[model samples]
Target: MERILMSLQYNGAAYQGFQIQHDLKTVQRELERITQRMHQQFVRIHPASRTDKGVHALEQFIHFDSHLTLPEDKWMHAFNSALPNDIVVTRVNKVDDQFHCRYDTIGKMYRYRVYTNPLRDPLKVNLMTHMPYDLNITDMQKAARLFEGTHDFTSFCSAKTEIDRKVRTIYLSKVIETTYGFDFVIVGDGFLYNMVRIIVNFLTDIAQGFREVDDVHKVIEARDRTKAHKTAPSEGLYLERTFYSEDELKHCVAELNTL
Candidate 1:
């Protein structure tokens, strides 16, 4: 048997989440169903993260062991043929048995998009969250700078998470005005449940004059969820990338350092 790793790009609107739940549609369940059909046997697939409902991913990683000796390209063609149109396996490769899809991951990049236009676009309702008020991008960017480096993100996370540590490194959190809307890119070592949403809400609040920009420090120091910003809508969030090798990631960091 060979352990194969597959990177998936999925539109999470129709699925419940990544994990399997009774009677609920999930990316993993669909992929597993296809894999089982391809092999004519039951197969278990493991994913790096169980993203919440309505949250999309540009690059999500999953690994599974297959006794069938199929080429990397065939995995995508065969698996996607049986799967739904929204989910696609973009890449597949055979990896070491010791390599875990989740644990071995060093960090992930997520983008939360918000439409700050005066009028909402009908097509973007399912994709981007629309906020009519003009946002102060400068203030928001300044507030986002506070999230950089190592910090205890307990206040920003959702309630009742089981993670032992709340400290996470935020490599970059920038607010950029894109052609369509405002984009918030947060690249971090790891994230807590609803952390990105909460952060975005806080920064957006600061931009909207609902909260003071300096209040971010107060919330961080308090370590209370209520002290932080409210959790934004989940539909705007997308996991953009997940880094695997520490060496590869280090090279990325070094490249970024020179920039």
Candidate 2:
């Protein structure tokens, strides 16, 4: 058997999410169906992260063990040919059998976009959030800084989360003004359920003058769900990248070297 790693990019607007669901169309379900058709066998695929409904991905990572003896590079071509227009297998490679996508991912990066114009742009409706009012980008940047470093992000997480630890490191968080609106990029070790969306909502509130900038620190410290703003809509969220440091990748290879 050989383990394969794949990098996928997909528009999430037409699917339920990444995970497989019987009644819904999903990235994973579609990929798995194509894999099974190509190999004529059952396959289980594990993903780096299960993005929520309406959340897109530019470079989602996943892995699976296959007994088929096909060449490594051909997996990309084969999968792409079988996938629909909305989903594409951008890259593929052979990896160690023990390399699980979720466990091996060192960090992930996400971007949330907002359209800050009085007149809504029909073209951007699928890609960005339309905010009719002007947003203060400078204030949003200041608010973004408060989320930097390690902190218990309980307040920013979804109430449905069951994880014991809410603390996660934010390597980078920035709000930059774009031609359309604002772009919020956040890179972190991991995120809690709805964490990014909630953070965006809070920052949006700050930019719109609905909330004070000092409230950012207060919400981080509060660690209470009620203290945070509502979760931002999923349409603006995109999984930008999943990363593994050179050292981490080396370590992973070393551990599987003898296999």
Candidate 3:
């Protein structure tokens, strides 16, 4: 079997999540179905990250092993032709057998978009989170920066997460101004379940003057999930990119910081 790596993007509103569920539609199931049809055999794909339901991905990755020869140059177009309108493979590459889509990942960037106004934009309703009132963008920006180091993100993770290691390093965390509201961008070595959304709500709380700016530190130090507010909605979350090496992660984060 030959190992293949692929980069893809999708509007996840249609799927239950990235992983396959017996009675539910999912991203993994769709890709597997298409790949199986093309190869004339079932091909299992392993994703770099399993995104949540209703979350979109600007740059997602997956790898699979196939017995049939799939021309790297033609696979993207072939898959696109068969895939649903919301999903598309952007690129494909042949890789060593040892290269894994999930295990080789070193870092990831996720963005949460927010739109503010009393009236919701029907078009963006599936993409951005709508806030009825304006948020203090400056305070949100300031609060986001505090998450830029190693911390036990227990307070920021879902109580349902089973991972024992709660400490993770955040390479970059900031809120960028957008015409509507703003986007909360976070780049990190890794994340716990629901961490990004929880952090976003915490930032929103700070921006709305419900909590002190320094409460972020208290939340981290408390190491208690109850300290954090409810998790933000899934619609705003986007898996922007995945990194495999330190050099790539550093360069991309540096480039992102300048934006």
> Judged by lDDT, which candidate is best?
3
TM-scores vs. true structure, each candidate: 0.94, 0.93, 0.96
Q: What's the count of clashing pairs in each model shown? A: 0, 0, 0
Question: What's the residue-level lDDT of 23 in candidate 2?
Answer: 71
lDDT of 2: 0.86
lDDT of 1 at 87: 89
Q: What is the C-alpha RMSD of each candidate to the true structure, in Å?
A: 2.0, 5.9, 1.2
Where model 3 places Cα greater than 4 Å from the true spot, the runs are none
**Which ranges of candidate 1 are over 4 A from the true structure?**
246-259
The pairs that clash in candidate 2 are none
Model 1, TM vs. native:
0.94
Of 2 and 3, the candidate ranking higher by lDDT: 3
Best by TM-score: 3
Misplaced by over 4 Å in model 2 are 246-259
Task: Please provide, for model 3 over 115-204, each residue's C-alpha lDDT reduced to its tens digit, 9 standing for 90 to 100.
Answer: 997899999978999988768889998899999999999999998899899999999999999888899999999999999999999999
After TM-score superposition, the amount by which residue 73's alpha carbon in candidate 1 deviates from its true location, in angstroms, is 1.4
lDDT of each: 0.86, 0.86, 0.91
